[model samples]
Target: MTEGGRRTAEPLPTEMELLADLSRLYKIQPATALWRAVEIREVLKAGLPTGRGLDLGCGDGALTGMILRYAGERPELDGLDYDHGEVRVAERRGVYRRTFCSGSEDMPLEDSSVDFVFSNSVLEHLTHLDATIAECARIIRPGGNLIATVPAPAFQTLLKAQGRTGAAREAYVTTMNARLAHKNYLDAAGWAALLSKHGFAGCSATPYFNRAQVERWEKLSAMTAGVLQKLGATNALLYRMQRLTRSDDRSAGGLLETNRGIARWSRHWARIVAGGVLDNPGTDDRYGCLLVSARKP
Candidate 1:
């Protein structure tokens, strides 16, 4: 992963800078996509491929374009995602040479077509990770790189459930996972094993986004999404209501982004963390996320 999180030749980005970039083009008032900037910066420092590459799970192609521009490398790239609407948006952006609207587990592409693949914060939410990883192994050429940013097991510990101990923390972790739609939160060794099982070798996982940074994101999430999760058992009515009422899936940025007041406040929050460092104090064993890298064998 770069030698260390903060030890790079490039200037460390402030929270406002990231927020501005995300919010700019009518996006985040400093949305949770701050996480994307965190992952992208570290990935850039680690050196990504600039040849035939794939942006796996690319959403709207905006973030992928941002990462490439930031890195000063314009690799010939193709994007893949399941959402037809999103794939249309990505196609309109002119970012990818080719775009596929398909699920990760069953991608529509040639074998060994790309030298490298980059996925940002996409793998953890998959219910079928093995299938997706196996597909990645198939598409990337031998010795080609597969780089991704994913949630680490430490992610649960880094949440705002700080003072809670034992079962309380465990419950919070479980509830948060349900609310966040996260299925896998593997550590370095677990990820290496999974990659190896799918014909990937030389796997390395570098955890990033330290405690304070993640806590800030969590607090922001809590304020916006609330503490209560709509886990279907008891809140079935509310869940059903939400499913019926929430039609803003096609909105820019997010569902809340369409709200005037919410957009204003979100922008305000984006500016509050002016000099917030992306990876402060550097990534340690306790960091919340991982930048995993591997090679097709």
Candidate 2:
């Protein structure tokens, strides 16, 4: 165990493995798919003369690479994560100019040093979320932007309702919370409040959840698996069942619809399955995630 009392039995993986895993999961070319709609490109296009940025919780440095490529000048980029194995992997991939093993609440970089700070699906994992937000405020130069995404609370609560009882429920909660230290799913109002408390200016958020898209994906995966099963494909059945079971499988009637109805108004279902869901456009009513952008005041 390390000094923090957490187990250290597993060493961090090299960057190659991290890239390989992401490539498989996203089912697209690396670098391209990972940063596609998160707007890292557009944000960089605005141009930071200083060419310095930080990628917090940069799992495998996928975003880190995109940031570097977008900057186009080999700007001073840093990537940090609590997992040393993942950091090592990033280092091996040549993704970040500098890579370190660090946590959200305790970044190693100096305060007010970076021109920009970006995190994708990262902030929610922090146990000390407020402290980390304060740290993000501190480290970013005045007027620098902090762009991030967080799971919408309504969808999470809906998942919880379906999760009802047993180990499955416990596992669901544990996984959701672990993803971003998501103490609770933050609605737009909740997110704006957090940003304002941290002295962030002009805080804006976009809802990105799509219940219909998620339902479609689930249905398609199920159908594909069924077809394979009919052809005597045992592995296909197992895979399809795994996906279906993992999805929020509660019927769309009674209590579940009521929960979804609440979710609709709160805009708590925006998600980043691969990247931003720009192809599907509708009001915030259908979104399940929140993409929040703010600046240090």
Q: What's each prediction's clash count? A: 0, 20
Candidate 1, residue 71: CA error in Å? 1.6
- In model 1, the number of clashes is 0
Our model 2 lands, by Cα RMSD against the true structure, at: 15.5
Instruction: List per-candidate RMSD values in Å.
Output: 4.9, 15.5
Candidate 1 yields a Cα-based lDDT of 0.72
Give the TM-score (vs. native) of candidate 1. Answer: 0.81
Best by TM-score: 1
Kindly list the per-residue Cα lDDT of model 2 for residues 1-297, writing each as its tens digit: 231112234333322323233333233222222223333333343333345878788866655564454343455678888976567667766767888898888788898989877776777656788988898898999978887766677555434224357777777556534422466567778878998999998887766545543333333333444345446757534433332321122221123223445334223222333333334454436555666778786
Structure candidate 1, residue pairs in collision: none
